[model samples]
Target: MLRRLALATLATTAAGLGPLPPLPLLAPAGPDTLTVTIAESGHPDADGTFELSCGDKAGGNHPARDKACERLERLAGAAEDPFRPVPEGQPCTQVYGGPAVAQVTGTWRGRSVDARFSRADGCEIARWENLEPVLPLVRG
Candidate 1:
C-alpha cells in the first residue's frame, strides 16, 4: 500500500496536476506613528517637527525614516521604554552634552509613548543617543 501511494503521488506531480491552495495572510502590524520635535537654538535649520510612521511600512517626513524604523523595530523587544525619562536620583555625569532638546510622542507596539530627550547631562545624553536617528544625532 505504501509503495502504491508513493507511485501515485509521483505520477500526479509528473503530470503537472498540482497547484496548492493559497493560505490566508496575516494582518500587518498596527499603526506605529510618532511626531518628533527637536529644538536647537544654535542650529535653526535642525529645529522642526517631523512625522514618523513605522509598521509593515515606514512612512513620514523624517529624514532618516528607514533607519529610524529599523532601529525602533530592533528595540521593540526590550522591557524598557525607549522614550522613557531617566530615573529620578540616578547618578549621571556632570559633563554637558548640549542645549538640544527633543520630544517623541506616539503609539508604539500597542502602547502609548511620550518620551522627552535632551543632552543636558550624561544620562539624558545616553537616553537621546539610544534612539539614534529616531532622534537627531547631536554633537556637544
Candidate 2:
C-alpha cells in the first residue's frame, strides 16, 4: 500500500498536478524587541531577529546561567508564527531552537524544506528556508 501511494504521488507530480496541502503563513506579534518574517514559495521560509540587553553587572555568580537566562529572555520577548511547508504525500515535524540557532522542517508538496536562523550580531539575526527534491507542483 505504501509503495502504491508513493507511485501515485510520483505519477501526479510527473503530470504537473498541484502538490499536497500547502503550509499556512503565520505572522509574528508581541513586544517590539523581536521580529519574525516568513516568505512563501515552492517552499516556505522564515527569519527572526532578537534584541536584548546584557545586564549591567560585568561578572557575578552563575555567569553561565545568567547568559542562558538572557538568551531565553530574548526568545520569550520575541514572537513566533506557526507557519510551515507541507510536501505531497509526506509527513514531517518542524523543530526550532538550539544552542543559538532556530530551525524548521517539513515536507512541502512532495519536497522537503528546512530553515535555520542564528544571531548575526548583538541585536539582529536572520534565517532562510530551502526546499529539496524539487517537484513539478505549482504553488497555490
Candidate 3:
C-alpha cells in the first residue's frame, strides 16, 4: 500500500476509480515524501529544512532518516491522523514550551498534509511531540 502511493497508483484503487490518469510526481523524492522545516526564534543554527522519504528504503536528508521514516509509516497506518491539530476549545495547560516552531508539508499515506507545529502551549507541545523525530525533539 505504501509503495503504491509512492508509485501514484493507490488513488485509483483506494477511491474505486479503475485507474488514475498518472499523477505527476510531486518532486524528486516521488509522491511519498514530506518536507519538514524547523525554526527557533533568534536561534539561527536551530533551523533547518529536511526531506524525508519512506518508500522502498528510508532515504533523505533528515537528521534521523530511519527513525523519522518509520515513525511516519506507523502514523500513516494509525487510526488517528498524527498531523491533525488539537481540537478547538479543548482545555490545555498554560505551560509555555519555547519559541520553536515547525511545519510538515507533503503527501502521506496517500493523502496531502500541511501541518504546523509549535510549543507555544500544552496542546501545541503535545502536537509537536506526536511527530517525534520527523520534527526535532523538544527538551522540556
Residue pairs whose backbone atoms clash in candidate 2? 86-107, 86-108, 86-109, 87-107, 87-108, 87-109, 87-110, 88-109, 88-110
The lDDT values for all models are 0.84, 0.33, 0.80
| Candidate 2 lDDT (Cα, 0 to 1) | 0.33
User: Scored by Cα lDDT, where does model 1 land?
Assistant: 0.84
Using lDDT as the measure, what is the rank order of every candidate, best first?
A: 1, 3, 2
**Model 2 off-target regions past 4 Å?**
1-99, 122-124, 128-140
Task: In model 2, state the lDDT of residue 85.
Answer: 28
On a 0 to 1 TM-score scale, where does candidate 3 land against the true structure?
0.72
Identify the candidate with maximal TM-score: 1
Q: In model 1, which residue pairs have backbone atoms overlapping below 3 Å?
A: none
Task: Write model 2 residue lDDT over 21-109, tens digit each, in one string.
Answer: 54466423322121222222233322232222223321222223345334434543564222242335553333422224444344222
lDDT tens per residue, model 1, 1-140: 76866777778778897643444564346878999999982566668999999977899999898999999888876655687788899999997998999889988877777888889899998988889889887889
Query: Model 2: what TM-score?
Result: 0.18
